[model samples]
Target: MIRFEGIHKSYPVHGREVVALHPLDLTIQAGEVFGIVGHSGAGKSTLLRLINGLETPSGGTLTVDGQALGTLDGDGLRRLRRRVGMIFQHFNLLSARTVLDNIAFPLRLAGVSKAQARARAQDLLVRVGLEAHRDKYPAQLSGGQKQRVGVARALATEPKILLCDEATSALDPQTTASVLQLLDGINRELGLTIVLITHEMDVVRRVCDRVAVLDAGHLVESGPVAEVFLHPQHPTTRRFVAESEAIDEGALQEDIAHVAGRLLRLTFTGEDTWQPLLGRVARETGIDYTILAGRIDRIKRLPYGQLTLAVTGAQSDEALRRFAQAGVHVEELSR
Candidate 1:
């Protein structure tokens, strides 16, 4: 587990201290995949480094597994880093080293005997499904395979935590999905605590249990991925959510300008998604509704749907009431 209490970071820029991260109070639960999402310069990458002590904080404290990072000496910090592994955006691998030796590098650095390290690395190769590529250099492998090697190397130490700094950002969409699935498997099997920073909301939706939205160094929103994705509160959070859903607010508004009736956005999750709520409500309330835009999707296995609809006639108000009574979140939109 990791906890940050009023933690903030700064650096000197032209002899003036510029804040890179705002005061943060967050707790990443044990064995859960936590994600920090933000655009470039939003401080998410800085937050990830802060977790493993790659970046020192200017104020407050960060504790990982009961060890206060600020209190650690150089040797203490090195020891603690062995318990936390990190993977990078570019698949940081020694170009000259074969996949086998690259994976064994971390273990060797930890004072593991060459033979033992090679054996452990060989086993990780199998675990990450890169056994066939063990003898190949980084240059010979595909992007996905290269990232797998990076993952294998990160796991060489068998750390309790894994820090992924845009580990899949460089990969294509399909490759990203495969790599994320691998991470999900690692979390489920080994129960490793994963802290990843990414600009892609799909990454969080696919694997993260909880997520925090950062903007201009501020923690704009933090909560279960499903909640934040469904009902984003902050402006930055909303933009991220909208971008993920590919919803162009301006375009949608223009498209609906001529539409009649009261516009409402309905959100439903889990079993509610399977129920014939729309048909049932329409029948019961005698309300005619038109779905303007919507989609059914999953948020880390939780089924959910958000439908932008138009409702007309007298029963529209009662229909909205029934939707609320059935636990569907409704938000009114302009005509």
Candidate 2:
């Protein structure tokens, strides 16, 4: 339940104004896991800060749940911020505070009674699977555990929306997966709306329901994760998806040329089935197929498949046309 219309934010740099966010307009619905992705200096972080009033916009309107954030003063914004929680990459916990106390800190700020806060903290510790480590300090906990404490603390206030600023970036791959799973669980169970910003497409692929691509302070693309992954429009979006696929374009091209065959890359989504298409192509067309690389995975709980094939036959064009007629995308690689 957030809307940003014609939002702009700029700063003075080297005696000239630099735009960090260039009049972006976006809407995030309630109970949705939305992702903002881009490289560094893409203003993704800046956009998140604007939502929480950490950075005021230079022009235009920002509304949260129908309330205009731009009109709110310091005290009003403070009150509104309680309904929004944020988690950081570095697991920003007070090192001196124990795990339980760290979670309790937010409740304390909100003037939650000690006994009530303790009960809430205990429940959160248990929720995050950190009940046994409640007495341990931040330094004693592992990176994942520390981040769990951060999550517990962020949830302490029972915020409706959670802002994750590269929450999994600092963790190892295994730990990152664990943390992402936790976020997914929270969103499903609590119906909490989560807005996550990260450079990793894998993270978005695993957890995000919808994603928005930002580049040069502009909103380039936004849609369901599966749709965006299957048909990326922007250059940056295509690059991210290609990199995530780990496609070796140069090598694939060389192999295709040397083999004196056409290289076709096909993507299959939920509506289309890959096995039937592969079978039909083999049975109908006399072309022999060499599958160089391929993968099938889930995005937002939907099947997404990709295949790279080298076809050797005089009827290669016919085979490609068959695939296209069957609604499969066929991209031919250059030599």
Question: lDDT per model, in order?
Answer: 0.93, 0.89
Cα RMSD for candidates in order: 1.0, 2.0
Residue 104 in model 2: lDDT:
95
Query: Which stretches of candidate 2 lie above 4 Å from their native place?
Result: 271-276, 312-327, 330-335
TM-score of 2: 0.93
Candidate 1, residues 108-227: lDDT per residue as tens digits? 988999999999999999999999989999999999999999999999999999999999999999999999999999999999999999998988999999999999999999999998
Quickly count the clashes in candidate 1.
Answer: 0
Per-model TM-score on C-alpha atoms: 0.98, 0.93
lDDT of 2 by residue, 15-93 (tens): 9999998987899999999999999999999999998999989999999867899788889998888989999999989
| Model 2 pairs in collision | none
